[model samples]
Target: MDKLEAKNRIAELVQLLNKYGHEYYVLDQPSVPDAEYDQKMQELQRLEAKFPALVSTASPTQRVGGEPLDKFQKVEHHVPMLSLGNAFNEADLRAFDRRVTQLAAEPVVYICELKIDGLAIALTYENGTFVRGSTRGDGRVGEDITSNLRTIRSIPLTIQEKRSIEVRGEAFMPHHSFLALNKGREEKGEMVFANPRNAAAGSLRQLDPKVAASRNLDIFLFGYGKWEADSLPSHSERLKYLAALGFKINPEWKRCTTIDEVIEYVSYWSTERPNLSYEIDGIVIKVDDLQQQEKLGFTAKNPRWAIAYKFPATEAVTKLRTIELSVGRTGVVTPTAILDPVQIAGSTVQRASLHNEDLIKEMDIRIGDTVVLKKAGDIIPKVVRVIEEKRTGDEVEFSMPKQCPSCNSELAHLEDEVALRCLNPNCPAQLKEGLIHFVSRDAMNIDGLGEKVIEQLFQAKLIKTIADLYRLKKEELLKLDRMGEKSVQNILNAIEASKSNSLEKLLFGLGIRHIGAKAAQTLAAHFHTMDELCEATYEDFIAIDEIGEKMADSIVQFFSEEKVIELLQHLSTMDVNMTYLGPTQSQMTAIFSNQTIVLTGKMESFTRSEAKKLVEANGGSVTSSVSKNTDIVIAGEAAGSKYKKAQELNIPIWDEQKFKEAIES
Candidate 1:
């Protein structure tokens, strides 16, 4: 094609790509299949290559992420991304209504939107073309992530109108996408990001927008950052204008004239949130009129014009009856508390993790001790406490096993540690546990090989170790209980597929004590080859950042064992990707830096680990109590005494939404 024709095609493709991106990313729906999108993108790239002058940096083809950035360039938000105040329940919501009514010159209307559980970012469009994007750093200066931001198919590469607009929205990895990404990362030995929020932030912060582009990150525009074109009088009207500008605005937002309607919207989503592919912590309530918002003005951090009504947490109580100890693949004993059958949130609960022996002693828990059980965020189950009043003299104190329960090997405890480990590499418990970890969703991610299948294999003597899994015969698998030819083939395919997994995943799958997915990635990157890592000393391993002394020692000791060396050889013959999987580092450090957080009660928005991950991503610490040292206590429903403790201590307490905003900030 001629230069003029190429230029025109590039512009047209850019516009079309932006439209498709909006339909897919902004909306929870997609109009075109991925193949169709890629076809058009490739055509645009080819045309641009033929005519370099036509390749404007803003073109859709320019969105492929790049190399590691030294640092993210700071961008001052044209309009500050103001924080929202919070209301815990319908009562507090009505109180907010009462307060707003008292302060208002007239009856006010409210607009409510689902508060998305994701990273907050500011998008800038100059002369109708998307230019830069940044995190909501301190609500003012944020790191520039323009290239990575453009990879979000929903983020309009260029606005239809020639107005300079700053848009405020959420950059989130959808739950489904998060699961898939984590699964893929796990197989490669990369550290799986703790939650979608961390995944999204880590993806966007990549200096190479190409990496971000591949992550399938998405965004939803919630409010106008700063706009000066044709003036919009109300917040609700601006939302409509944004939708008209080909920007994706949340479809669930409602213009509620009464407090009852607001309540209805909040109620609908509290139960409905689970059905969505992404996560929302609460609902955002804003005055419909921008003029009213101006009048309401601000507090120290939050906007008076807006308040977030949080959903009640999904938690229920069950009695802890007994504590059972299970040996991990690394032979570390982890305590699992058996509970009286009870319904919690949406599932049946019979067990909760007691974490370790120290935790059991710290909680002063014993068998026959009635304890409160909690599934924080409706995902992980944990024993909250021992009901000391119900304790009988028959109550038994729990102890860590002195030997491997499966193989009768002697157990040892490292100095200054709580985990009791069985050092025998050939321990049956360790083999079974290691195989489980190896095929875990965060590791090899073989779909059909769950615990039951593994147990059956163990019983049949078909697999003794993780490497044995790679050598399973189809005929043998089909002979097992509930195994069909189709199922056996599928399992075989998955096992074969796992051979391509990166090195870090294999390290984590090895079940070395204290070596989590993150630590695995750190070790893989630092050592590059499995052979090199196995030879490293504790001091050498400890030199890596975030690698604590205990973890370093665990790695060194794991490698020193002859049985482990044999296992590594078997895995090497299988051809796994034994290196870093994605961009090795992030531009934005953990957001919740140095602040301790305690999440109590039922968290409606995110699970306990998911919440902890959010805190960790933002440079904050997550703890288990309300203390003067605690920065924020994220209190949820049926909070019991922790809420009272937080209030009593005057610790900065945040309901779900406030906590979300605190992390985003």
Candidate 2:
């Protein structure tokens, strides 16, 4: 066929195949037989290969496209993927309803949906074509997994919606797919995933789109984010319209006019959950009206407009095989119960935290006893109670060990603290655990330096301190068992990259007593630099609203140590960033402070999210459209309606150059 004819054929085939796929995957109906679909797909592949330029990202053949990615890029969410609050029982649901009613000063409608037990993702489309997809990482930032997401049949490459849009959804592995994956992994002598949720999450994180496709991942669009001219009055209509746009909307969602109906929906799902094909751990209840949702607004963490009624943790009786202990970064030794493998809440319950000796004594938990095991919050495994009736006379009581498991150091039970800790500063386990925490996702986020690599490094005596990580040489790393040249290069690059992370990461990575992530953030924002923080007194810390006496004292103590001061200096010489990368106290009220800005058209240097972050960090807010209230419009090349609206409204307009200069100034 000629190129022109092939192009027309490709377009025709693309539309036809997409229609068939939507019917088969999303609607659970097939317009054509398998043979016919296969025939048309084969024809499309041949035509595309003949006219290579005709092969497009949206082509049916490109679902599992290209080579595996070396690494995933970070994407900041335009609209933060805020989490919903929880309602455990009938009273909690009623309380939520009362709050909504009180705020609206009228009866409010609500939409209830099954909270799919899977990973949350946001998909962005421009001109009705899918462009990017990402995980809901820390609400504001996420890993870009657009290639993996494209492999999911339920997600359309193109939609009927002509305008740009962002949609949030749950990506999940169906029960059958989960079973098949586990069976395949077991056959291959690989570690099988514990549950479908874990399986889904792992699959999406794969560097290869083919691997993600093999897992048969699916998604259900839950809601839209930052859409232009969103005039839909209610959430239910929005869902229906999204479904009409060839998106997969879960059929289980319901619109309720009263709280009683919402309660009924939750109650029915509680029992009927077992009958569903996929896993759903809870029912999500959201205010139906868009106006009501806006009126309710949000908390610092979660949206006040929605609540999740989490399902009760499933219980299983299993014999406690043994007890094991592990040391954390702070030297706190934790005891875990190893039990006979038994299924609970869709995952195998083989281990649970016994907490400390006090809990063990209070509950009288013993090995060789048939104990009742339940996952805490349906996530962490925990021993709820002892099945005393099922316990035999031969059951042995568990005792806390006196010596550290890794270093064989004497353990100390700190005053007023329940956890037995290894107070020895030089304990190997503490150092090893500290190294792991330092590179963890929420800390420095050195992606390749996982627990196994840290342990390997510790065992080899090649690294000892957090500073030693920055000192790692490629030649030495290549000496390790699994470290190939490429792997070692990536690790070194990641380590070097982490040196420039914002101050909050390093503060949290330090593992200071009584200072958790939030406190670390507070300290970072207040101190602005490590030098400033090092000189802070307990009084200085206590002056902050959230910093309690204990946390303040811990912060003061941590920075006062000569060893820590030396380490910071050493890291600084290695070119690590010491100053705060976020908004400083002085810059908080800069030129853009308290202004509402709108972005339009194509950006040359930074992405829309990147620009938004810049504006927000310096105390400006980014809104969707230009209006009389809009303080400035950051117009880029091919600036569209928003730019025109800014001119019409007599709002200030700035090119990217001016916006950059003003922010920098």
Candidate 3:
């Protein structure tokens, strides 16, 4: 075939493959065999190879395309996609009901639906055509994944309504599909996906849209990201609207008038969940009324209008073969229960964390005892309960060791805390863990230094302390496997670049016990330099609001350590910047102090983000859309529904030029 004809043929085949994929994955139905799909894909690959320039990211053959990304980019969410508060039992459900009644007063109804075990995504449509989709990254933001989402068969490429809307939902791989895929992988000697949720997440993260398409993914629309237009009256009505507009809504949804009804729905699903084609961990209960939802509002990281009623803990009985202890970087000894291989929550379970000595003692867990294990939140397997009747007399009870497992240092127990800790300054395990934490993304954000790389570096004896990482040479790095000259240079460059990071990064990088990123930032902003921070007394640190006595003591104790002092000196010698950037010593200034502004639609003159920056620069806070609280709403051309919402809210609205003029004025 000629170049043009081959391109046309490839497009046709991609459409055919996508259709088959949708049928197989989304609908749980197949129109063609795997052999047929593979045949078409291979044919497309051949054409693409022959005409390399014609190769596109959306091509069917390009799923799982390119190498794995070094890092996921930060995407600020258009509207904060807050998580739902969890309701563990009927009492919790009743408490939620009480809270809703206190807030809404009059008769209230709840939208009860199956809580799908999958990755959450936000889908944005413009002029009834799907344009963008993103992962619920940090709730405030998510990764842009428009291409990957387009591959899902259940996600309509175009809606009949010619209006913009943002819909949020769970993208899932059904249990049956997951099993079939895993079976195929097992036959091919490839690594099987741990669970359906994992399979869906991994598939969606693929860089190539074609690879994502091949995975036969599906979605069930649940909520709106930022609703455009006010046509839908209630939450239930919106779901119906989405369904009418060609989006798939889970059929298991129900409208519950009382907490008892919600509990009934949850209980029914707890047993029925296992028998379903797709995996559902719990039932999601949300307020059905849109106006009530608005009045109910949200908390810091969760919505007050909705809550997830999780099913009773799913547990699998497994034999505890042995007990082992691992000494962490902080010299905390955590006992692990080595178990006979079993499956629980869709993954093979071999070991479970015993957490600390108290947990082991509380449960009286012994080697050779039959224990019930579970994976909570789909990660971290833990022993839930012991089947004492199943335990043989030969079972051996374990005790917490007096000495550190790694360095043989004496362990010490603290007040209020359960875990015994090794306070030894020279503990090797603590040093290694400290090094790992120091180089972690939220700390120094040094690229190419993951857990595996840290382990290898420690084993190679190239890094003895956090300071040793700064001293690593490019030539030495090149000696490691998979480390080409370019890779080596990248690592070296990243390490060098880390030296110039903000004081907050360095403060967090120090890995002081009980001090998190936010605490570190606050401390750094309070003290201009590391030297000032180190010299500050516990009382001085505690004087700051939010810096409690415990945190102050931890900070004082950490800075007072001779080894930490030496480490800091070494870092200083390595030419690390230890000073402030944003506000200097003299400035008693607060820039961008509270003024409310709302942003709407696409802008031609300036990007939405850029406009927000301009607003912040002149002391104004830019919100997602308009409301009564909005001091001003910056509306660009084709602002659509948010523009209308602004009008309804009676918020002051301005065009792009007027917004610019106002900012300057």
lDDT of 2 by residue, 1-665 (tens): 78888999999999999999999999999989999999999999989878888888788898888589999999998898866666778998998888888988877889999999999999999998999999886566789999999999999999986779999999999989998998998887566898999999999999989899999999988997768786788899999999999999999999998999998999899888878889998999999889888899885446778888888887788889899999888999999999898877877778888889999999998888888887875678888888888766999988998899878899898879999999887888888899999998778989888888998999999888999999999899998887899999999999999999999889888889887665676678888899899887888889987799888878888888888888899999999888778766564656777889898765646677668767766767789977778998997654645765676688888876677787677
Comparing 1 and 2 by TM-score, which wins?
Answer: 2
Cand. 3 Cα-lDDT? 0.79
**TM-score for each prediction?**
0.57, 0.66, 0.66
Candidate 1 residues 131-201, lDDT tens each?
A: 78888765656788887887787877777788898889998887778878878987875556666777888
Question: Is candidate 2 or 3 superior in lDDT?
Answer: 2
- Name every residue pair that clashes in candidate 2: none
In candidate 2, how many Å is residue 100 off? 6.0
lDDT of 3 by residue, 561-616 (tens): 89889989998999998986544324423233576887876564577756875675
Model 3 pairs in collision: 63-211, 77-140, 77-141, 329-430
TM-score rank order: 3, 2, 1
**Model number with the top lDDT:** 2
Worst 10 residues of 2 by lDDT: 636-645
User: Which sections of candidate 3 miss by over 4 Å?
Assistant: 1-22, 31-112, 122-131, 134-143, 154-168, 175-216, 222-264, 285-308, 312-316, 341-350, 373-384, 409-424, 484-487, 502-508, 511-566, 580-665
Give the residue spans of candidate 1 off by over 4 A: 24-39, 316-334, 337-352, 355-665
lDDT of 3 at 516: 78
